[model samples]
Target: MRLTVRHTTTYRYAPPRRAVVQSHRLTPSVFEGQQTIWWNISVPGAWTGATFRDGAGDRIETVSMLGPVEEVLVEVTGEVETQDLAGVLRGHRETVPPTAYLRTTRATHPDTGLRELSADALAGADGDPLDRAHRLSRAVAEAIAYVPGETHAHTSAAEALSLGKGVCQDHAHALIGAAIAADMPARYVTGYLFVGDEPMGEASHAWAEIHVPELGWVGFDPANRCCPDARYIRLGSGHDAQLAAPIRGLAQGVGEERLDVSVDVAEAAQSQQQ
Candidate 1:
């Protein structure tokens, strides 16, 4: 399938910051399942610097803006051809050991409740790691109702599990916690999910990727109750959401930072061969 994506994020500072610096993971991953047709990232009045691929095989670019800048807009326009790899991340190069993901962050730190949830999710399930992973994903989807606006960036997996409701990020976090509790290494993935016939999902989507001994890293979206297919585009991964955020930066002398994001992912028409 071919897809086109347009994502724009605007940041406004009330008092107009002196300077702003941002790191982006906005580029799509290079893998067997996906190919970039055309892609670009634009930030007016910003100097691009030090673009490099990280150990996780994600392209990272830096942008610096000198301000008196009240507003900054970052725009991304791209087209990609994607194939369904059954959520198995194949043909991607990365140097980081999968065991590195076993380390938990603040958002995914498992408490007693999360541990118990993991136990219950896996109880009476006699299967290999892959089968058990699916079961755990289903458990998370069932346990947490997909209710947007119920949580925030600081919300933890334990909190979301206790509430029994959250958005995709929360679901990913809770599922990551469950995977860790089961002794399976898991990480958070940030990317776009093309919800067919819709303008877009609420925002750019997030999911969990677990390292299966035989299959390597496999993507699972508990919120959607399935593995990533052609409809999904993988961007980057980290121990948790913040680490894998598409945009992370700092503004000097900011009164307050307000952000607005718009994303649209749609299937593209195939061209006829001559």
Candidate 2:
């Protein structure tokens, strides 16, 4: 499947800031599951600082703007040919050891509830690592209801689990926490889901990748109750959402800022024929 993506994020500061700097993980991941066709990222009037691929195989780019900066726009347009590899991360090069993900961050820290949730999820499973991982994902799915506005950017896995509702980010965090409690190394993935050609307020997505002794890292989306198929586009992975954010930045001065994001992901054929 060929997928096309358009994502735009705008940041507006109430009072102009002195300057701004940001790190971006907006490029798609290269693996057996997907190949980039053509991709571009544009930030008007900003200088491209540094670009490198991190240990986790994610391409990172840095941009800086000298202000009186009132508004900044980040735009991304790309196309990728994807395959259904059953969520397996194959033919990907990365130097980081999977065990590194066993270390939890603030957002994915497991509480007693998360530990118990993992235990219950694995009760019916045997010794297969992949099977246990799938069960863990299912458990998270049943535990958290997918309610978009039930949570916010700062919601942690424990908090979301207690509430029993959240969006994809919450589901991913809950699954990551539970997997860690089960002694399975897991990480958060930031990506795009092909949700059709219709304009949407958001198209970006999140999921968890569990490291299995037999299959390496496998992707799972508890919120959607399935593994990532051709419809998904993997971009980057980190210990949690904040670390995996597509755009992470800071300004020189303190001021209130508002953000608006719009995304559209469609099948390349469908987009071209229209």
Report each candidate's C-alpha RMSD, comma-separated, in the order given. 2.4, 1.5
lDDT of 1 by residue, 143-220 (tens): 899988899999999999999999999999999999999999999999998887553255389999999988999999
- The stretch of ten residues in a row with the least summed lDDT in candidate 2 is 194-203
Ten residues in sequence with the least summed lDDT for candidate 1: 265-274
Tell me the TM-score of model 2. 0.97
How big is the RMSD of model 2? 1.5
What pairs collide in candidate 2?
none
